[model samples]
Target chain A: MEEISKSPVSDVPTLADVAARAGVSTATVSRCLNTPDRVTEKTLKTVMDAVNHLGYAPNYSARALAAGRTNMIGAIIPTMENAIFARGIQAFQEELQKNGCTLLVASSSYRQDLEEEQIRTLTARGADALLLIGYQRDPQIYEFLKKRKIPAVLTWASEPSQNFLSVGFDNRKAMKELATDVIGKGHRTIGCISADTATNDRARERVEGIWAAMRDAGLEPDTLQVVETAYSIENGEAAFQQLMSGANPPTAVMCGNDVLAVGALRAAADLGLKVPDDVAITGFDNIELAFVAPVPLTTVHVPHRRMGQLAARALIEALHGRSPESVELPTEVRHRNTL
Target chain B: MEEISKSPVSDVPTLADVAARAGVSTATVSRCLNTPDRVTEKTLKTVMDAVNHLGYAPNYSARALAAGRTNMIGAIIPTMENAIFARGIQAFQEELQKNGCTLLVASSSYRQDLEEEQIRTLTARGADALLLIGYQRDPQIYEFLKKRKIPAVLTWASEPSQNFLSVGFDNRKAMKELATDVIGKGHRTIGCISADTATNDRARERVEGIWAAMRDAGLEPDTLQVVETAYSIENGEAAFQQLMSGANPPTAVMCGNDVLAVGALRAAADLGLKVPDDVAITGFDNIELAFVAPVPLTTVHVPHRRMGQLAARALIEALHGRSPESVELPTEVRHRNTL
Candidate 1:
């Protein structure tokens, strides 16, 4: 299938080949290729035609070998189907580009095995540095990075005690504060729609925070009806329905993220439940969906763009042989109409 | 800054180094690494620890030099801030993965120069195939791809006469059909919110479609007030405000896509204007934002996931030396309350 590219590497057409084909000096061809204004229009056209005829492309791989660095950074995110990681990665790429680095993104669909495979694939492909999401991976991954002398920075979640360089907010604290506020609103019975907590540290911490908040509010943590599911609006709706179907339904619903809350709202409409009046709702991650939803969502806001920019800087500094420190960004609970 | 990676090419540790450190043969080291079950647990531990100590990652570059094929595909999209391109790209990657190929993604921020740069960068990185958006680009790019013998298929837009392989719905015809429907609702004066058409062929075609529909409806095409801007909710809101500020504003507003339509709905709420009652609105690319907005949006549903899958197959087939024909998908206008 890939046979055409199987031509002997030595057979690759060079600039000299193009110059010889066009009957022009290598210097004229180079000038026409890089800075066309130095060459006459006729010379430019002749050089370009020869270039096309020869199918000559400057080999970055060839130069990359010479430079000993490709200046490409790889980012392994969980998924690309939602806006959760979109804004952060955008800012991360922007900062990297400003420093003459390119980003290669590979989504693992939140699977650890796939993530581990990509970690090796990107390394094998020559990524100078990596931007990872969270720090709950097997210690062998850290040892691999350590042995390879590759620098990697974590994002989305933070651990103060760990020495790993990271830029993130306390997901547990943020959700806990939101849950406390929901409880403060006089809703004793609360249901939670959460992403599977086992593989997700962020989801786990957020769930813990809610339990802590429930305890602080003098409510039985077991009384908090929890529905575990994947992160999707459809899943959120189903979870909300399941939680509400219980004989003793909660007075309010708290979701793991804005996507889930939006789904819960959709389910509310489908089930003929009025938001806040029939059941109050809250979410985490103050994404645009939080605001654009039919009922503006009360959620916790994480500085996604800033976190991405800072994470890029940390990775770049680490690549430059600097010991960049971990950063813990704060999250604020945004009180909108839903609560 | 990248000097740490400046170690001599020979300094990279080899399998022999790990074997020597672990007091095992190269075969034992290889088996311990690839098929650990064949080795004793103690041997596995010693080999892994030594592997970590030496940081011996299988050098893909060394093997890639001999293989002449990397089996990597690159997809360059416009932006990551929204969901418009998210689903399509996710599907594209899934199809490529199922075919034993890996996908590398780079965002161009919708800039032509940046896209062109990424095209070169991804190509230089040995992408066997490429999935690009739109058919409108300098023929020089096609020549370069031809010269490199790289197979690339276009998505999102198609032109039959051009002979460029693509998988897309007709943006002009789809939007024209929607405009015809809006016009059929007895709105003579219609205004449009569109993306800047100078650089984007999709936006230009959709605008042209609206004008064509206006003409067919016996209305002066020039009477269609158009606001050209970037594609963002904030930009959409501002453009909607500008278009509606006119003394004799059109009764209906047609947007280039659902993002803008959702923003227009937000603006409608802010301006205390009733949707459809005061001003009817329509959009293209019925993204999730369309359905989740405070007011449900009616939009043309482009087969994004299907297009992604088909485009991946076409590029993969081309990579396999097959002349896959371009497949044009169909679009449908989803009827909802806003229209």
Candidate 2:
């Protein structure tokens, strides 16, 4: 190990030192470090070589203990890397901001264990209230939040039989309506591209809705085929290919969300299948992608932004001792060109 | 306001109370609040009515001081409502997670003041390191980070002249090459849809690259038609319309990123303009949207996941008393059908 012969504060090789060694400006040194793409390859190498030669590293251990109580809220979502939850969470954050509250977000990547860990993590880190998605987590988790006296608001679904306060909509009914619409269009053999229905109640309810629609249409729900995968354009494409390549391909494909539908559309195009004419497609959550999709998707439009704003308002009101009524917003079916 | 006359914990009507009154399970009460979409309209109304009638409010004032030093990293992104930064940030969080560090994220909504405030807030909240975007923020900010011994990594751009450690590609070069290729296709008139170049160095450099390509081709850069706006599909569409409807519309359009380019493509289609035949278009950041756009887009591909992973490694290494060299990744231009 290198010897610590000099004072900790003064001896560390600064970016300026690297720049001086490389014959560049402090700004250039930073650009080389922070925005090397703006610099020439030659300049980039020169600065990087200088940095390596000088041993320049910025000290980043800035964590400190808070002095006292602060106005902060915490939220845990399935994932932060997609548009499905983006608008809603953004609206949630904005509403919190209006009430002078800061939102701390953690993504679970759709893993239940991870979600529980993050919930505890945020709580340990002193989050005042927690905003969570969906309602299918273990009952023990709810008991834990209650035990900790951490009021939580659930999003993306509403269960009138649950103990938790939720500001959400009916996923099962929304999907049922969409499925009914597809059935009305004379679709018989319906195929579904759904996310994991086992752990995710939302996905499960969506499938249930489709089954309900099928039963209503006097069709045997058991005859319907489904391919369960993660929510992604690539997965959706693969699922579509799997369904269409089968011996008895579906006349219409119903996706759990718009992301999957977009993928299904891409798959259809690659297979040279015209949407609505060759095989119709439907998606849930009329995200911006739905309208701009290869074929504008016929899907359910969830009020993401409104749901977020309402969730925030509900939590804020609760914090102020007002029991905001459990609000259940509505979803609409947007009939686009796809079906 | 009602007088506080009862014990804090015992008086609060839990979801169980609402459920009991509504003749449902505590789970149903939670579902009504969190996932109304999962419950029936009738059950949702009944639970909500009970909640309002019982004046049941969950207590959320759980803010407390952190026990001590902990492993945590903080990131402040421009916005959370889009896919542009999602992949990169997720990758960053994953890397941090592998090293036993949790990531806390804040969205700044692309406002400088908000970002500055969040930077301070995260710092005050005791983040071990910071992952930030771009290279154009105030120099004083870097000084503040250094003064506090806060290790920071700048993403999205690699500034060869800055003091901050960055893991990014050359935005200017990536876009310039795309523009050069567009120009080589025998199109003299060009149009650019860019974000605010003044504050966003990445956007500014992207425009500069196009201008540089124009100059190299012996074209007057001043003659290039330009439209500046926020980054969104709607704005991109409107900007495209403005560009095409002008007295001298460009034969080719270059967008700052894939999102804007998709919008432009939509506009082109709506106006009955066939892509490439009537007007060629290009974009930066070959996001998933680029490939799925009405026209598969020709754009520059930035290694988003890799950038995020490398940024995380840099900060973690710095945290561990290791001086890691700044990293600058490469970008490629994909010439799809749009160009």
Candidate 3:
């Protein structure tokens, strides 16, 4: 390839240029670019040849403004640093493409203000609808979306809020089941490592669910040691060390997610402690890392791909003036060697 | 939060409306939104207050068209399904934000056609500049960008082509160093697993580098067994198994990336093979997972954060009419337990 000049060329091709080259109307060129399947095979080949020869690029902004909608759906995830949300988001994007909608995704890094700003940015960029992770943002954001007539569907945690569309599993219920399984293994003393729940409803709900299970089993929920940290393997390791340093260490440790659980497993190995003999550990999210861990982790299996697919379909339906109903998916706790 | 109606409010706020309420000109409102540091503190507060009171969102399309620049940089990565590009893209986004620019990221899933489409979509959406992964793409796309005068910077793999700006490391040199280290460990028979090299320059270069190192060490490079797969842990594990099942298996296994290396380690364990004793393993890209693996991996440590930060700054400079020179960062060979 040769270096092209930075200066703008005078004869930049337009839809009209393509139309003249293909011997068709400008509308036909626009149709070929936007909805190629709608054009006849012979006309499609001619217009595409013209498009290639003239190197014409469609003006998305002009087309969006003229059409009064961009057919674009935006999603705001907490972060993409791990596999926790990757599978789900991939499914969501594929579903959106199937529905003729493009996905524009942004990461908030678990910051409420940043999320709000991204919501505005996506809306300003002409997103017809949105897919938010949780229903914990400020009321003002909802108002802004409402005023702009942008439909949004929340995911990851099921909140029975009629005011918002949601598609997710019950986080609290899933955690309770995992806790019950850990307790059923004859472990009375237990420690918990949870993600910082300040702005995360899912993490908070998971912790509460674990507490409920402990209390129901006649264990002192108040006495259960809890360490809150960022969702990382290193943090999980640090939290595990802190818990084990106490005079009366627990026999079992539960983590907020798979990333943290994998960390605990690493720490256990570093300490020369055998899993399921010296201590048992559990995790949530059942990400691929759980299976790849030195000791395969016992975790709650949330339907990530299903959540993403449902959220995309629901948002698209809502955009078409059909109110999308809330969906609650089921989760299962897998009892593995970790327990 | 209450459900807001789907209908658009007739009294939607505009920049002019904010200006009227703040007792300022529309230009002041625009400046307050785009470049808050340029506005006086008092004026900024007033303008922001007015914007909040009216629930105003600046129309990005209109603003881009009016200013002939969006102050937005778009990045088209291979995939976001794993941690391969997460750390670098995070650094890129942070650097872009610091430079008063926002980022719009899209993933191509390693498909050349999808990548080309994303480039055109981003350009048509008014991205002032672009960050492409490699130099390989349709020539017509380059022609289109040149005609539009869009500044683009390639990343992830350094190329000698002066046709474009790039910020990355020498993939071949990095891999050669790792392979040489493996050979020095008294390993003659070595098998390699790599990502499909058809559309990826980095993967192709890494494979070539390994062959170069093997041939230089008097090892028959043609005898080296190679398995090409996707850059995933599961694929790595399968590849490892296939290599091990063959007659006269290699004493050492090399992987294209850390994900594959981790998989190979897992497969070795499942097959009751010992690391460094029964067989040795090597990986590239010292991701966190490499350290957390049961046996730590010896790999090449690329400066992901530095590459991202440099790419952003250089692109911004190029957009400002300065020709940014291509940068080739250094990679280090980390000799850990696996080797």
Candidate 4:
């Protein structure tokens, strides 16, 4: 076995090498590799033995080029530094695996140009379908996918678009509901600490939702102080401090997500302010941290896992030439003690 | 321009089509794509125009198979549900990208069989090198990598293996230092909540380190209560509750990492216990959550990002036929309010 496997190492094994070792034609080897059931049992055994001996691995990209499918699904997410997309992407990968598809993931550092490049790269590597975060890319990318006949589904934000498929929640509605609930508690002056909304539709929609709620409550939405910063606990703390520095500090602070909310809670503790008493705090995205925070955070709960599973199913249907229905999972408010 | 780009789309564009469109031989187009400086300015311009019109992307796998280098590094992590490996892997990827390489990631859910399958899949997909979490796979895997001449580096815990390369911190040493510090703080009765150590060397080493510290402090190490569970905030809370339910609860609860430490803190809050006054708590891996926790956690600070960056550089050197030296980044105990 060692001798058979120890032949002079080439860069990688070619079909011809396997054929030579098995004493068969390269066509027979290729047939055995792709459609083993169609080949005779003895021939299959002979080819496989030679294959194992040579440590031969099928060139996935080469095969993808020939068949136009790599049995692989690719996703480009904004960032992996937090638990924001962790649960959802895990579910997405599990669902894809159940369908005999592997997932290739790349992070874009929340940059649009990098996401565009990742899309092209995944497609070039022969991803049969793609799972994108939002439908906010340049129109040429959609045209490019159309030209290549690759299907893609947008997730995380459910904004209806005639040109794309989506599986997510209405971020604006979720945030608006939370904001309305916050207002019902009789807190007039409010402050917002949001993720940088320039490249993130969810963050923008969420801020808009808060504005709509404030406007509905007879509060001047334009007067509401807002701080846009990168999503980090430290940033959230800094933003909270900035909001509190005003002469008449807002009675409440609403954050874009639970991570920032946790930061605000930490800051509240550090500054010796009582939560829901001295100041109220609310967050979007009820990730684990929301419940585990010292002061359980009041936040919006998005169905992340379900959306991921649905996105996988939708992309698989599209791959099979069936247009899967776009889905919008519901979100709700988890009224914890922080509010 | 639309007409020029609207040629009958095959599954993907081929060099032959680009060559025909440029009215040049395939070799000239290949040269233009691979070594543009070798092509004349006019020829390069014509070839690039044809390439653009056809939306051509070179098949990376095919190129890799021929050259034995994909310029792609693959890492198989235990899971992505936590922040444990996120910061490190992100830094590793950024470093790899700087060296003109792309990263392919897969999570194995800490199952050895699944990890082995991922290793095979990544190699089949033409990963030039692999970044594994630990040196804990079947011996056959090491042999398989050696047979294929695929370079690999173990990370997270620096346990030297003559057969492999490692770039990490000494888990046992770091944990022991923390345990010693807790002991010095005058806590005799100690409890531990750790991630399942059966499959994780890092967790196992930390637990052993705590035991070593207890024995060295003239305390009965075997009397220390321990709970092994999944690394989650809720799990940590439950584990801490379990330890406190014992006939004699420990004066201090030591966690394998900060996530568990946070959970332990939450449990203490719910149980109406004051940290340090009623019970002290210490954690490993000073992730951002440690500092932000209501009672900032005392924990071991591992240089996650630097380890990741160093791992990438070492692997790249190994790939280039240079046997890079293994690095052991320092770890220190961070004294905080928890202890």
The TM-score leader among the candidates is: 3
**Candidate number with the higher lDDT (2 or 3):** 3
Residue A323 CA error for candidate 4 (Å)?
A: 1.7
TM-score of chain B of each: 0.87, 0.80, 0.93, 0.92
Q: Pick the candidate with the highest DockQ.
A: 1
- Per residue, candidate 3 scores C-alpha lDDT tens digits across A1-339 of 011123343576888999999999999998888678899999999999888777677766666655556666788888767676767877887677666566676778888998988888778767778989878878988888876778888899887565788998889899999999888899988999997788889998998888899889998888778899999999999999998889889899999999999999988988999998999999999887787677889999999989999999898778667877899999999877799
Q: To one decimal place, how large is model 3's interface RMSD in Å?
A: 7.3
Q: What TM-score would chain B of candidate 1 score versus the native chain B? A: 0.87
Order of all candidates by DockQ, from best down to worst? Answer: 1, 3, 4, 2
Q: Pick the candidate with the highest lDDT.
A: 1
Is candidate 2 or 3 superior in DockQ?
3
In candidate 4 the C-alpha lDDT for residue A64 amounts to: 52
Show where candidate 3 strays beyond 4 Å. A1-11, A37-40, B1-11, B16-28, B34-47
lDDT of 1 by residue, A1-339 (tens): 122344345666788999999999998987886578878999999998887777676554555566666677888898877686878988998888777677777888989998987887787777778999887888889877876767898899997567788889888888889988999999999899988888988888998999999999899999888899999889989998998899989889999999999999999989999998999988888888899999999999999999999999998887776789889999999998888
Superposed model 2: Cα runs more than 4 Å off: A1-69, B1-68
lDDT tens digits by residue: candidate 1, B201-273:
8999999999999899898999999999888888888988998899879899999998888888888888999
Whichever of 1 and 3 has more lDDT, that candidate is 1
Alpha-carbon shift of residue B8 in model 2 (angstroms): 6.6
Ranked candidates, highest TM-score first: 3, 1, 4, 2
Residue A167, candidate 1: Cα error in Å is 1.5
* Native-referenced DockQ of model 3: 0.31
Docking quality band of candidate 2, CAPRI definitions: incorrect
